[model samples]
Target: MHRSLLAGTFLLLFTTAASLAAAGSSTGLDDEIEGESRPAPSSQIPLPQEGDKPEAENGEPPEGNVTRPDTREETPIPDVLYDISALPEPVQRMRKLLMDAARSGDIENLRPLIGTGANRTQMALGGLEGDPIEFLREISGDDEGQEILAILLEVLEAGFVHLDEGTERELYVWPYFFSVPLEELTPAQKVELFKLVTAGDYEEMRTFGAYIFYRTAITPDGEWLFFVAGD
Candidate 1:
């Protein structure tokens, strides 16, 4: 009975040893297959660079995009003024008066001087006063207004160039209505007259002129401005 038990124990030990050996061999085969199928490490893969980046199939920059210059250019404006002497005498006269009125703030006497011809009627003042410069801006309307302005500009240029030196003379070409003598105005007043004559025929000029003069004062420049407007 002892001998039979020893033999059975030996057989069991052998079977166990064989099973362990087969498992070791199967494990080694699985490891080899896994190593062959696995992908390479991330560091080994190729990557794109800025210069090497792929472009659109059509070769244009991507959709909804455009390129522009870094700097912008400025446009130039045109010169509009013509020679001063080329304008008519009446235009020249009106330009002078408008500028004169501007500097003086003389409106009361400026009204009757508006409109063409000796039989001219008074225009609506539109209730402006105190500042004839502002009035000159108002009375002159549109291109017609521009004519007055251009003329004034010409006269201004002329006065500055030709009459620049010597005694500053005020040209008294007679008032239209009252037979009052042309008063020798203060230098300040003379400057006002210069502005009135040159500020152009803006609507504000008329209103301001009327307000300043109210009754006695006359704009020697207004009639000529009106005549220029007609032409």
Candidate 2:
């Protein structure tokens, strides 16, 4: 009877120990699964917003993302005058005299207005060799100088510019192109210029970097300063 009782006690002890071990193992497995499924903490870092774009080292907006504005300055065009009635009395008188002489078609009529030594109208940049009238005739495309006379009339009829106002060098210059940049001329202005020069002549002047063609200048006091060509 004592042996049977001891056997029953051993069996009960083994079964209780086995149950406790299985419960402990199940609790450990549950803890492992919970650790893997739990979400991360709310204190973690966040991603950048759409407006938070990065800049260049020079403080400019990044190249591909922005377009910079053009800050270069443009050249100003000069004012062109077409009316002779707006000129001073002396200037108007001289212009009328030149027009009359040019219309006469007699190159000699220009002589008296051209005046004598020292006050004579300048016909060339470098001084003329002999008589001014004869020199004009020589340079004329035809024998009678009609072409030159026509040119003179055409030059006076074109638009003019008044420069050096209030100064000793003040004068009225013909064919306003003399004071304007070739590159800056408008299409209409270019057409007006074509009336005075051939397309080839315009291209040559552009290459030379200035309007080196025939241009006339008269002083504010009615003196015909020059009717010449060249730089």
Candidate 3:
């Protein structure tokens, strides 16, 4: 009986050790897989946000520019801005206002771009689909949100270059899965895309196989609607 008890004890200890080993192995393997194909984290990295600046009454040079999201890792592209001059003056004005608010991460500043109370209407805000104020809070609180804001700003400023697998047409456009819908991504792109987009969008895209980024939709009348990113 004592021998049998000792044998049981040894088996339990061996099983526990094996379970731990399996867990560790699987964890390491997962990390390795994630590190290999995780959307390459866009081209740029994040920069820290700045504290509020004193108002620039009149044409004062304003406060020192907040260090925008760092582009240290991004391959340099030509500094060409899209021509919004042909757009209606109001659209131009609203776009400018929205760009400024996003760049500064100023929630109050977004008021002018968004409509007034009761009449206040913004079509959409985030990848997960939330309100503008909540969107502001989100980007304000998180570095990745800031990065998303920066990407939107850059796309607005200069048109984005669409990038697809094995394409050399690398225009000055924001990278996107060319032609293919977000819902139809191949197995490899799908794996790389898992954590890149919101879970809601990801699941939807998985069904659709095509994903679009830097999407800004305004009403035909020039009302600022929504801007969404990722898969």
Instruction: Judging by TM-score against the true structure, name the best candidate.
Output: 2
Candidate whose lDDT is highest: 2
Candidate 1: 10-residue stretch with minimal lDDT: 39-48
Model 2 / residue 105 / CA error / Å: 1.1
Query: How high is each candidate's TM-score?
Result: 0.21, 0.65, 0.37
lDDT of 1 by residue, 176-221 (tens): 1111112433455345434433223223334433212111111222
Task: Evaluate all candidate structures by whole-model CA lDDT and list the values in order.
Answer: 0.26, 0.55, 0.35
RMSD of model 1, in Å?
A: 46.2
Ranking by TM-score: 2, 3, 1
lDDT string for model 2 (49-89, tens) is 24322222222222221111111246344479998899988
Candidate 2 local lDDT, residue 138? 46
Clashing pairs counted in every model? 47, 0, 17
Candidate 1: residue 79 lDDT (0-100): 22
